[model samples]
Target: MTTKKQKSNSESHERKGVKRFESTTKGSSMIEFISKSETIFLTSLLFVIRLAAATWGIINDCDEVYNYWEPLHLFLHGEGFQTWEYSPIYAIRSYFYIYLHYVPAVIFTHMGLSKITVFTLVRVALGIFCLSGELYAYRAISKNINNTTARLFIFFTMFSSGVFQASSAFVPSSFCMAFVFYILGAYLNENWSFGIFCVAFSTLVGWPFSAILGLAIIIRMVFVKRHILAFIKISFLSGLCIGLTQLIVDSYHFGKPVIAPMNIVLYNVLSGPGPSLYGEEPISFYIKNLIVNWNVAIIASGIGFILSLWPSIGRKNQKGVTEYVSPIVWITATTGLWLLIFWKTTTQRRTIFIPNISIYCIFHCTYL
Candidate 1:
């Protein structure tokens, strides 16, 4: 029963295990091992930079005033302005995710903290949340790609204006970007529970429109595992839990029953004439916007896409090497789809934010 091939294969596996242990002792990556010290330094730098941004980044959007800060102010002081989006008539905005930030603000404020102090605390908290998402992104990318590539994209995310803004701004789009980070990471790692929770939370509480991003992961899981019913069950349960929490909190606040997610879908999509009531432009608008935000990343993504199509084009024979073309191909396709959908449709600046997030995700994923 001890065939020559079997003995050779057993010896090969033993050799690999020994080599891996040797590499571990030598402090060299047999594959990819990023140092804990470097990760800590980068994380600290990200927090400090985002905090600086919070202190300096002026509130630019009126929606940030009405939809987030105002609601938060009301939840604290019992009086704040409202907007059409938060109108009791429409209930397009949910207070559930908003409460996640401001309820703490209220507590701290009640505990003798100044508004300015509590605001800083809130910003720091948001930065930490955003950083958490990026940490997941980093882990996902590092586990699947070259360590150097993972570190480089970490730099990109740490320095990105969009990311800084997202961390500092009090909008659902910005907040959902935080969730987007974890969802992508969980998708790659096949952590179905976390992936479903994040997707559901983002869509149900942060922004219903964000389901667009979640759809990518859902499709992949459903198709790959050939378990459509399982995914549906998970999604339904997650959505029900998140949606019910939002309905309760928002209903109490609005003084009526409110299914905010459904209202959001009705207003933004199913309503007659559509959200074009705000503005619309040719698809070229988002292309121009992306060029402004991420020109270099876009160029690099094109290079990655080309490399993925003909993986052998740039690859060479390397004994004992593990190839990374398949993941790159999938990342290329996902990022391509992200860009096409966000850019080809009617758009706004907040809508454009997803592209920057996608670019970061693709850039890191392709680094494999």
Candidate 2:
């Protein structure tokens, strides 16, 4: 009986020792995971600080464009859904953004909200959008690259001089940047439903041009070959839903099935400067404006463009050249197409935001 009792005591001690060892191992793993996560969080925080500094510098030197003025004015006057003759071009454009501003304006107007309140709210929202977009960009890049490299790319892209200028002067473009980031994140995961929802919400926030996000889906299908069919299907459905909803809203208010009148006028005024110089304006006019407005981005992008083609410069054996080659090709091709098809105007600074950001991502991911 004594021998048997001693044997049972020995077994119990061994079992306790094994359990303690396992617990220690798990504790170490949890600590390591937390440390890594904290590092990522710190990196993102630093990036935001850098971007905010750049943006603040630009805002201090520039005045806000009246982009939000028209919408605010209309809402203040109780015009509700009425169109402005000066910018009637909005009817054919994305109405969602205008409505976003309208909601606040309507509520405030009814409540007799002060001018200071309205302006403060708008500016605060803009700041949040900028920060959120940068965070999203960092997350997207980190998925494919190391955290340090992803943060560096996001920092450079967000704090670039051109981005700073656009964020300060171009209100709509700032919102568009946020939407683009959201779209990229959703696309990276092949989350078509989320992507489409983001695109729609972005379109409402003054990025009517978000209709162009469809191009990204097509590019993904042709190049990445990830969920191509689902992407196409969801994109079409979401677009239809957004369009029909807009039409119904407009028809109910303005007796029209399209956007507001002011938007139309604005488009016509800006759309005059097309890809080629053969139209009404001289080549120098567009060239001069492009250089002046996109000076910093253009210079950085030019360097990236050249670097992307040089295979022997930064060749990595692990991923091969395909990884480097694909992104470079995509950025260059899309940027060139954009310059060729769209009217290059300094006023539309937001046009270059996404492409520039993409270029920055490629540069850091491949070289840095």
Model 1: CA > 4 A from native: 1-34, 310-325, 355-361, 364-368
lDDT of 2 by residue, 1-368 (tens): 56988999999999999989978965764454346676577556644654454345444222133344554565567433333332333344434555766676567657877766665555545545566665665565565434565656665655565555444233555566656666666655556688677776556434555446435545655565566667677767876776677666655545555654235434545664422223344445556655665555556666666666766344552334334344335433454555554444333342434433444444444443
Please report the candidate that would top TM-score against the real structure: 1
RMSD of each: 4.6, 9.4
Count of clashing residue pairs in every prediction: 0, 18
Clashes of 2: 18
CA error at residue 319 for candidate 2, angstroms: 11
TM-score of candidate 1 relative to the true fold: 0.85
Alpha-carbon lDDT of model 1: 0.73
Worst 10 residues of 1 by lDDT: 316-325
